[model samples]
Target chain A: MTEQPTEGEPIRTGIVGLGKMGISHFAIVNAHPDLELVAVADTNSFLTSAIKRYTKVEVYKDFKRMINEAKLDAVLIATPTRFHFEVARYALERGINVFVEKPFTLTLEEGRALVDLAKQKGVVNQVGFHNHFVGTFAEVRRLVNAQAIGEVYHVTGEAYGQVVTKPKTSTWRSKKSEGGGCLHDYASHVVDLMNWVVGPPVKVLGAHLNSIFSEGVDDAVHAVFEYKNGMSGQLTTNWSDTTYRKMTTRISINGKKGKIIADRQEVRVFLMPGCEVDGYGEGWSIKYITDLQKPVWFYMRGEEYSTQIDTFAHNIKSRNTEGENTFASAYATDEVLDMIQKADRARS
Target chain B: MDRILFGDNQFFGVNHMSEEKARAQSMKFKDTAAIMKVIDVAYSEGIKTFMCTTHDRIGEVTDIVRDNPDRYNNFTFYPGMPYAHKYANAVGELGIMGTLKKFAPGSIISTVIRGAMAGITQDAYELMKMLVDAEMQRFQGTRTPVVFLQNVVTDLLLGFNMREMFRAFHDYVQQKYEAEAGFFSMNMPMLVDVLHGEGIENPIVCSNINKIGFRMCGGIEKYIDTLKTKQFRPIAMSVYASGAIPPEEAIKWVCELPKLEAIVFGASSRRNIVGTRDLVEKYWRFDN
Candidate 1:
């Protein structure tokens, strides 16, 4: 692993891409007691100029120059999915810890290369599968591990949002070449959570990618997955649903003796007469996120965002590479994405 | 600050406990009249201080309140600024510069010049003032005694260690709007410390303060200590912990906290509104 920073000195950090996510990360990173945000790079001049004018941190139009000049101990890459591989690769080659936003890379090959390079450099590497940090989802993982829902036989992962009810113009998110689609922009979260709670699927049984609003990309994705042990699951995601005010992800696990349904806000579990789990009733038990979540030092839209960043910071400090949502784990999710795509193609 | 303020989260489909309930609430309050109906109920119950975000829909509510001054007599609004979704949507529709030009609080040319000047002088405080003015536009022709910075921006600024922005907001609101600046944060203990460090004594701050400590960043003990000792006006939100705690216990617990200046809760029905008002009146004595 890279040499740990001095005992008292904050970890030098830089962030690339000042989009919505990037700006949020900037605030969190800057506020972190153990992180010193030295510089930021974004192509948007207005954002860069605003940062330069408002704060003392440096700004740059080129991320490469920022990495070279800032001498960052870690870098957070929130660029479009197409740029994740390039930005993360550059940082990893220089022995800098990297935290890339979700949908790790555009292709499985690119994700594999980064995973290997991160291992070679012995640097901390993580992907932004933020659901892994959500308390309810994390609780779901714990319950599944403890067999609270005994021997999960099936699962259903679903996500819905009002991202594009009516297609007006195309942004990077609506363009397929830029890795904007239901699969990458939305469903990957549910898929990653599924992979985490239930083991990764060994095969894709069927898949359908539909373009309801966008011409170049799928607005909704549906697929079935089959595990090697004969367990099966499905993914249902849509970004064009007007019913949702924001993106909501839910996972339901069906076991032989019980069932568990969970979202960001709460987890619901139902057990048969003999199926017993600690702190849960035999008939039904409900746990709200407030009960499950630990307080974060800072909270923005949600606690998961800040918690993920804090976990990354702790991993870097402790020189631990095998934390949650590592590049390796994210690559496994990427491989699942590839399987679904190939399944859809074969069906067509 | 009013001792019992009614929030607008329920009308805006922001149920922290369940997505299904939030969706149902969204569908139920799809019309402006539907939202006003609940506000009228809360108003009738003497909870006249409506702590609301400056959502576009709230602008409509403001218009109704402005028109019917006799009905809403003594009505006060505690407006929270930088309704983040509005800005996010604006950025999506109009690019960043376009959004700046659209919401820059004045004529396009003058705003452009002022923006450039702010950039050159390195005075983001001026831009912040302008944006505050822009958000406060809808609350015009009404009484806004306390204007709050939303927790999203408040906590973000707190994270950035930007103490001056807090001071700037406090000073700007006091001077221009003739109002006390309120801050909403998830981390109450940290924010109270930061505001005190900025020399803002007896500051008005709102956060989640409930029996279970749901969303209380520094935990219940630290919050209790802050409430017991800090020299600031504390307004408790999420008192029910998003429906996890029963109303009786929740109201009783928070009402007993030391130095609690106000409690804000949101409900959609007249029965729930009256019920909550009764609970507060039963436990906490409010002096006129």
Candidate 2:
């Protein structure tokens, strides 16, 4: 294992895969002063050479070779969902910190393996569930923890879009073997949010998985989840809804004291009779994330992505075991997805 | 295909409008005999075709129909496959791969190997084909002239742009099972357009066709336009709009449509069956 970097020294970072998300991470890693962009690996030499022109970083077509010889402090594997397990395992087994993208792995078995490996290696690990870092979502979580919504009873997460209204057979997203469809692509975020706010679902009550826009994979996932704390919820995500312009995720949490509805732009809270939250009396309170967010250097749309990367960088420096976006927590969402995919009715 | 097909929603307690009524129907039709009595009423009224899902209870009905050749010699079943619940229930009983192995036809050894290699090396199309073969197993030796692709799978295929599977299912039924393929979808207008685009001429489509467009997707105007122009067989269902439309108005509006070839409805009593039959007989007439 490499020795921990002393104060004022940047953490060496390498990235694999130069896809859209991969490129986004590359920009973030390159821009961050605390993290040094060391190397990148992808099959496309054009992409590799393009990055080489801008920075004096090593580029390789082979990710394994980059991991073996790069002498990196951490690696961000931004490949598809199917490759997350193998890539993360390779990095984690060598005592390198990891920041893999969402859905963790396609299945629970693989996700659990990564979580175990990260724990065994004693390295900082985080899954790219950027929604968790959103201001409104964080605020909602804070209020819920403060008993703003007392005794949570149920939750519902709806994510809809018109991305795949037609057939999409060209990419990995269309194939079930490659962790394709809405359940893995979009619902993964919603599932993670549900687990974060309400708690991990103990059971899946009913599921209606449809490949309404894609073959072999599900384009829509509508499932009912029963949480451990006597709470029940439903998750509905359709990636082929022509009615929606772009993808949007909206979550509603209903507790005994009140209800909170959170979307991208804002959070709306409605207090009930038994409300006990301080500073705010019952009726309704609206908080827009736009008003609360601070400006970042590389601001594309939201700072959540940058915030997560910064958190991962700090964790690596401090030798923190893991953060809120741990592989273990992400594995819970994978388990719920597995349960919903495999069951027709409620499963305990 | 029969002009009037009887549905099994009442037998299965699928009343969309009233949960209490659905619960009562579920309690009443808890036994196969109760379901049989309703089917008998429809049959007695000359409703010979039964367009039904491949639910477990329907297996009993199929057995009864097979046993009584004299009474139900002309009864035809338009079996809908991939009964979404069946796979889920099976998975709950067995593990996901175990359920796949169990439902996949052929010897246990080959089935296990196929199930094991399903998502890895093998294509999901083979798995879907196997699922169809498994669901169609119970209706063997019976009159299943038109095999249906349920809306759960139908609309999914539409959304995915996997038109090849539609053609595959159509070809599979025609070549292997010697049956015409039919599609049941919530969105009739879109389904018709998609089926036609796939070179499927005059595809038989069953969808929600009511006076008020209860669940008729793609809007009522598009449906009317498609009905007026498309060269396909249309089967109107949910004519009563789950008790929203008056019986006479619902049946009359649907039966008078330009390209409607059949209407499927569910009723528990002889009186309702007779009423439906008389309404169809009165409104559906030849122009020439």
Candidate 3:
């Protein structure tokens, strides 16, 4: 599902970490006419060779060398949690725009440092919270901004899965010391979505961080928070549930005038008396995946993932740091996680 | 504790009394399919509750049950929290601060950093709650009648004199997760006293209780005293005392204990599972 190039010199890009997410990034970047996948790097020789087979891109074991030599305009850091900071730092310092994967860094300090450095370099940067590009959520943002929900009173979100349930050889994602856990690995997306859809939480009222399955790494998180605007909310996330096919997030917003319940595949809205939007009436209305999802050239993965990359590329061409997803916003999410962590540590 | 609960130690390689047996069970149940097969056997034998550790492989088993809801309708999970090895390895990899950030929620991650800079830590109570939430995530949509604080953390808190966490955990599990709280400990008598100090009466505690007193902290008499007099639910685990005692004598002794509500055991084969089931049913005097 390769799309024709959309005019002008494409943003030259390099990808690091040829894991599942890294490969996905490669295909989308390679196919998009607006961007060029110039080089890829990974410690795994097998993955790098696989990329070389089809695409004649520069391959390297050292991402630093690849970035220095490839002379790319942008880079995607898709490495493990431990490497996100160093890789992003390398790219931003070199004046290359970056699209780093989410749970942006191992810690809030790393995330903040990256954001500050990226700002200093004046590069367009974004975190890979692909849910922001999902049509349903985008629609939610639009309607919420338009006051379609009419003063959202509260919100509740749940993201549950069983991705890392069994004890295996520890990876960076499974280790707490390496910034692996449900909160960083999974809830980062959930909280980012909340901040994007609702407003940033002003105070963390309460929180529960669990390590049900993994040792030190958290497999679940439950938090209660309140927005600066007096909108209260709760976030529940888990990565050890055996029930889900993959990570699935469900959000429920209670507004002064209506209510909206949404997940990855669908959105159901209920308007209060006399609440009206341009396309919606005052009762329950539903939008399924087919209704909300945009068709893309590559139908193999979530359209939102490709859409997010496209947004990042377009933002680079326009010299806009404020895309639908931004480092500043991601930093905001990092700050929130830090707050919850400290709150958990400091709470009596 | 109404239904006999199946333990996941066999699947996850955690034999308390024997290293060799633990290793063997680990090898035998190494495959997820193998674990699934035994779980099915447990289910067929009418053991509906799986009081399980949140091991990575248990997720595979949970998925199997979740996929076939019709077949495992009565299935429930009593998920135990703070799998210690996960944290130990994590701390080794991420460092203390890094590990905290890893589990910290996104919204407050920055705040956590700021607090750390200012020399403040989120409370243990809050961490306990978050840990429970983390463990409960995988058991979602299933009947999690109770959530457990595993012996590692439970006893750690006991040693630190952080009895307040017991109350916090008890409250969080009941209020937040809408489930009862369970505690697994080697020192059942001390834990019972600690919970009592927190005003937690009739608490559910799973501990090793057998005739030989194998690994029975504070000896057998103290546990027997607590079991006989304390107004709490006792879920006897390691009734075979990690196989030091024979099955029939061990089962009879534990079943005769006062307030012994349930027994949790792990077995890889159908014969052992069926044998345990028969012994439990034949000997357990539910009336007493």
Q: Which candidate has the highest DockQ of all?
A: 1
Tens-digit lDDT string for candidate 3 (B51-87): 8888777778788888888998888888888676566
Candidate 3 lDDT at A65 equals 96
Q: lDDT by residue for model 1 over B115-196, one digit each (tens)?
A: 4544432346767888999899999999999999999889878876678789989999999999999999998889999999
Lowest-scoring 10 consecutive residues by lDDT in candidate 3 chain A? A292-301
Clashes of each: 1, 7, 56
lDDT tens digits, residue span A31-75, model 3: 676888888888765345434543467889999899889878889
Candidate 2 wrong stretches, greater than 4 Å: A273-276, A344-348, B1-288
TM-scores of all candidate predictions against the true structure: 0.94, 0.54, 0.54
Question: Which residue pairs of candidate 2 clash?
Answer: A212-B156, A212-B159, A212-B160, A213-B159, A213-B160, A214-B160, A344-B88
Given candidate 1, what's the lDDT at residue A69? 91
Local lDDT at B33 for model 3: 92
Model 1 spans > 4 angstroms off: B89-126, B197-199, B285-288
**Residue A310, candidate 2: how far off, in angstroms?**
0.7
Candidate 2 per-residue C-alpha lDDT over B110-185 given as tens digits, one digit per residue, 9 for 90 to 100: 5434334333212345666777887898898899989999886776555334567788889889988999999988
